[model samples]
Target: MGVFEVKGGRELKGEITPQGAKNEALQVLNAVLLTPEKVTISNIPNIRDVNKLIDLLKSLGVKIEQLNDDTYTFQADEIDIEYLTTPEFKEKGGGLRGSIMIVGPLLARFGKGYIPKPGGDKIGRRRLDTHFEGLQKLGANFEYDSNTNFYKTEAAKLKGTYMLLDEASVTGTANIVMAASMAKGKTTIYNAACEPYLQQLCNMLVNMGAKISGIGSNLLTIEGVKELHGTEHRCLPDMIEIGSFIGMAAMTNSEITIKDVHYDQLGMIPQVFSRLGITIVRRDDDLIIPKQNHYEIDQFIDGSILTVSDAPWPGFTPDLLSIVLVVATQAKGSVLVHQKMFESRLFFVDKLIDMGAQIILCDPHRATVIGLDKQVPLRGISMTSPDIRAGVALLIAALSAEGTSHIHNIEQIDRGYQYIDKRLQALGARIKRID
Candidate 1:
C-alpha cells in the first residue's frame, strides 16, 4: 500500500487543473464497446480505476491506442467473447466496480454478457441489483451463480420497454441506457439519473447514431437503433475534485485557481460551498478561491443549524460531503454533514476528531462538526485512508494541520485522483508519496 506524508501549516498557491471526470470516464469508456468503429476519447484521467477498466477492455480484445498522454482511440470490432469465461476475466472484472458497465455494451452488441461480482469502495453495500434489474427489464435473462458470485445475462434480441427505476442510480442508468440504445423498440426511462455524467453519455451516444432525447432531464427517451458508430468524446472536468479544491483553499487559507472546471456542469457544488462561507470568484472557466483566515458556516433562513446533505444531481453530491466535513473543521460555526447515500462514509470523522477538531459523530449517516474558527490549529496524526473520497478528505485535513501527518493506503486516493502528490507539489503543498 502507498502512503502520503503531508506536512501541514503551509498554504498552497498556483493554478491547479482538475482532471477528467472519473465517473464520466468509466461510463463513456464502456460505451465504446457498443460500436465497431474507432471511438476517440480525450481528457481521460490517468487514474487507477479508469486504467483498470481500460486494461479490462484490452483483455476482451478492444484495440486501444494512445493518441497522447490523456487521449485514446479504441476499436471493439474484434472482441473475444469467449474471454469472459476465463478465470482471468473474472479476477480482473471483479476488481473494479466500473467493470460491471462493460456487460451492458457487450450484451447489446454480442447477445450475452458475463461478469463476476464487482468490487469498489468499502463505503457500504453497493448492490448490483440496479444494473442487473434494469438490464432484465430490457428483455435480458438475468442469472446469478451464488457459489462463484458471478452474474450472467443473455438475450437473442433485446426489445426495449418502458420502466421506472427504483433509484436514479448514475451507473445503473448508464448501463441500462447503453443496452437500450440498441434495443429493438423505443425505450423510456423515467426517474433516471440526470447527472452531468449521464448527460455526457447520452450526448455521446446520440453522436454515435443512437437516438436519445432528454439530455438533461429525469425522463429519457431512446429510439432503438440497429447500430451505433464511433465518435469522439471529451469528458468534463471532475466536479468532485473541483469541490475538494475549493474546500482545500479555505482550510489551508490558500489562494488557488482551479482551471477549466466546466462550471455550468457543476450543479449545486458552488452554492453548497458558498453556504459554508467560502468565496468563489469565476474567471472565464476557472474558479478562483481566495485565501481566508476564518470562514463561517451559514445558518438556515429560520436560524436553524446548517445541515449539509447529499442528494441526487441538481442537489449536492455525496462524494464531496467528506470534503465539506473536513473544511467545516476550521470554519467559524457548526454544520451537520449528512451522508444519506452511503452509511459508512461518515465513519472517518474519528480521525478528524483526533486532529483536535470539534466533531461529533451523530451516527453512521451524519456528523455534526463544530468549527474551531481557526482559534486552534489541527495537529497532525497518523491515519489510514478507508475510501477514495475519505482518503482525499483526510489528505486535506492533513494539509491544514499543525505538523507532519502520515496517511496510509494512499492507493485509495490514487484510484481517483491522478498524480495527486505531484499536483499538490506543483501548487507548493508539502506533500510526498512514501511507497
Candidate 2:
C-alpha cells in the first residue's frame, strides 16, 4: 500500500484542469463490450479504479490501445466469456463495485453472465436488489449462491419492459440502461438516476444508435435497437474534484482557478459551497476560488446551525459531504453534516477529532462540526484512509494541518482522483506519495 505525506499550512495556488469523471468513465468503458467495432474515448482519467477496469477488460480479450495521456481506443472485437468465469476474474471482479454492471451487458450479449460480490466504499448496505429487479423485469432469470456470493443471470433475448427502480442507484440505473439499449422492444425506466454520469451514458448510447429520450430527467424512455455500434465520446470533467478543489481553496485560504469545469453540469454545487462562506467566481468554463482568512457558516432560519445533506442529482452529492464536513471545521459557525446515503461514513470523524477538530459525531450518519474560526490549525497526525471520498477529506485535512501528516492506504485516494498528488503539487500543495 502507498501512503501520502503532507506538510501543511501552505496556501495552494495555480490553475488545475479537472480530470475526466471516474464514474462516467467506468460506464463508458463497459459500454464498449456491447460492440466489436472500435470505440475511441478521450479525456479519460488515469485513476486506479479506471486502470483496474481497463485491466479487467483486457483480461476479457478487449484490445485496448492508448492514444495519449488521456485518450484510448478500445475494440472488444472478441470477448472470452470463459475468462470471465475464472476465480481470478471473480476476485478482481469482487474487488470493485462497478464491476457488477458488466453482468447485465454480458448476459444481454452472451446469454449468461456470472459475477461475485462487488466491493467498494464500505458505506452501508448497498443493495443490488434494484439491479436484479430491473434485469428480471427485462426478462432475465438469476440464480444466487449465498456461500460463494456469486450471482448468475441467463436470458436468451432480453425483452424491454417498463420498470420502476426501488431506488435510483447510480450503477443500477446504468446497468439497466445498457441492457435495455440492446433489448427487443422499448423500455421505460422510472425514478432513474439522472446524474451527469448517467446523462453521459445516455448520450453515449444515443451516439451508438440507441434512441433514448429524456436525457436529463428522472423518467427515461429507451427504444431498443438490434445492436449498438462503436462511437467516439469524451467524458465530462470530474465534478467531485472540482468540489474538492473548491473546498481546499477555502480551507487553505488560497486563490485557485479550476479549468474546464463544465459549469452547467454542476447544477447547484457552487451555491452549496457558498453557504459555507466560500466565494466562487464562474468564468465560463473555469471556476475561481478566492482566498479567505476567516469564513463563517451560513445558518438556516430560526438561528440554528446550518445542516448540509446529500440527495440524488440536481441535489448535493453524497460523495462530497465528507469533504464539506472537513472544511466546516475551519469555518466560523457551527454546522451539521448529514450523510444520509451511508450508515458508517461519519465514523471517520473520530480521526478528524483526534487532530483537534471540534466535531461531534452525533451518530453513524450525522456529525456536528464547530468551527475553530482560524483560532487553531489542525495538528498534524498519522491516519489511514477508510474509503475514497473520506481519504480525500483526510488529505484536505492533512494539508491544512500544522506540521506534518501521514495518510496510509493511498490506493483508496487513487481510486478516484487522477494524478492527485501531481495535481495538488501544481497548486503548491506539499504532498508526496510513498510506497
Candidate 3:
C-alpha cells in the first residue's frame, strides 16, 4: 500500500545488525500458548506478521506484556475457547501463515485445536496436509469444514506413538513435536525437520520441561510431560536478512559487514553465495563482503555451468534464491538459478529484464542469468513487489540501478523486514517511504 522512492547507484558501507529470525519467532511465540506461566522472549523483530500473531494471541485472552523494545512476556492462563468458533477468529487467523502454528500449542494445552486456512506468500503449493496428517497421527480427531476452510481437532487424551513424516516439513514437524510434547506416552518422529528454528523450539520446550532428544537431527524422540513451565528464550539473528545483505552489497558494489551472524547456524549459506563468485570473508562472527570490481561464477569440477538450487537442511535456503538470482545479474559470469521449491518466484525476472539485466527465464523453476560484468549499468524503473523475497531482490536491483526507482506494494517488504528504509538510510542509501 506504499512505495519506496530509491535513488540508485549508492554504494552503502556500514555495519547493519540482522533482526531476530522471523521464522523462529513465529514458532517460538506460538509455543508460549502451551503454558500458563509467563514466557519471556527477546530479540523479536517489529514486523507486520509478528505483530499480527501477537494480536491474534491477545484476542484469544492471552495476557501479553512488553518487557523491553524487543522483549515480551506472554501468559496464556485463560484462553477464551468460545472465540475459536467465531468468524473473526477464522478471518483474522487465516490472514497469517504462522497462525496455523497456534493450533499445535492449543491442541496440546486445551485438548482441542481449531485452525482457519492460513495465508502466506503465493510462491508455490504450500500444502497443510503435513500439519493435519501429523496431528491426526497423534490421536487427534481431524475434521475439516469445506465451506469455511476451517480445520477443527479434538482429543480426549493425546497418546503418543512412533510416526514417520511424509517430508521434513518445518512447520508440520514443529506442530507435531509440540503436540507430542504433551501427549501421554513416548513419541518418536523420523524424517523430522532439524532447521535451527526447530532446534531452538526444541531447546525452548526442554527449558519448559518437555523431554526431547536429537536436537539437530532428522530423527527425534520425545517423552511427553504432564505440563510445561515458563521460560526465557532468545531468537537467533535472521539469516535470510544476512544473506540478502550479502546480495545487496554485491549488486551495488558496496562493502558491508553483517554483524553477529551466528555463523555456526548459517550452515553452508556463505559457501553457496561463494559458489556465485562473490568475495566473502569472515571476521570472527561477522561476514564481510568487500566491494568487487568483477567476480566470476565457478564451474563444476566436470566443467559444467553451476546450478544454484535449494534443498532441505544443510543446503541453501529456498528463501535466498531470489537474492542469489538478482545478485548474479551484476557478476562476471553466468549461472542457472534453479528455484526447485517454488515455481512462481522466478517470474519476477521479467521486472529485472525490463531494468536491462540479461536473464533468460527458462521455465517456472529455472532461470539463466548472464552477468553483465559491470559493463552496463541497470536502469531503474517502476515495479511492484510480488512477494517478500522478490521484493528485497528488487530493492537490491533498484539500489544498483542507474536512475531513481519507484517500488510499489512495499507492504510485502515491510512484512518481513524491520525498519528497512531506516537501516538503508543509516548505510547511506537514499530511500524514502511514500505513504
Q: In angstroms, how far off is 79's CA in candidate 2?
A: 0.8
Off by over 4 Å in 1: none
**For residues 1-435, could you state the per-residue lDDT of candidate 1 as single tens digits?**
788999999988999999999999999999999999999999999999999999999999999999899999999999999999999999999998899999899999999999999999999978888888889999999999999999999999999899999999999999999999999999999989999999999999999999999889999999999999989999999999999999999999999999999989999999999999999999999999998997999999999999999998888999999999999999999999999999999999989999999999988999999999999999999999999999999999999999999999999999999999999999999998997
- Which candidate leads in lDDT? 1
Clashing pairs in 3: none
For each candidate, what TM-score against the reference? 0.99, 0.98, 0.99
- lDDT agreement with native, every candidate: 0.95, 0.91, 0.93
Ranking by TM-score: 1, 3, 2
Q: Least accurate stretch of 10 residues (summed lDDT) in model 2?
A: 104-113
The TM-score obtained by model 1 is 0.99
Model 3, which residues run further than 4 Å from truth? none
Q: How many steric overlaps does candidate 2 have?
A: 0
Q: For residues 41-111, write the lDDT of model 2, one tens digit per residue.
A: 99999988888889988999999999999999999889999986799998889888878888777877887
Clashes of each: 0, 0, 0
Residue 280 lDDT in candidate 1 = 97
**Each prediction's Cα RMSD?**
0.7, 1.0, 0.8
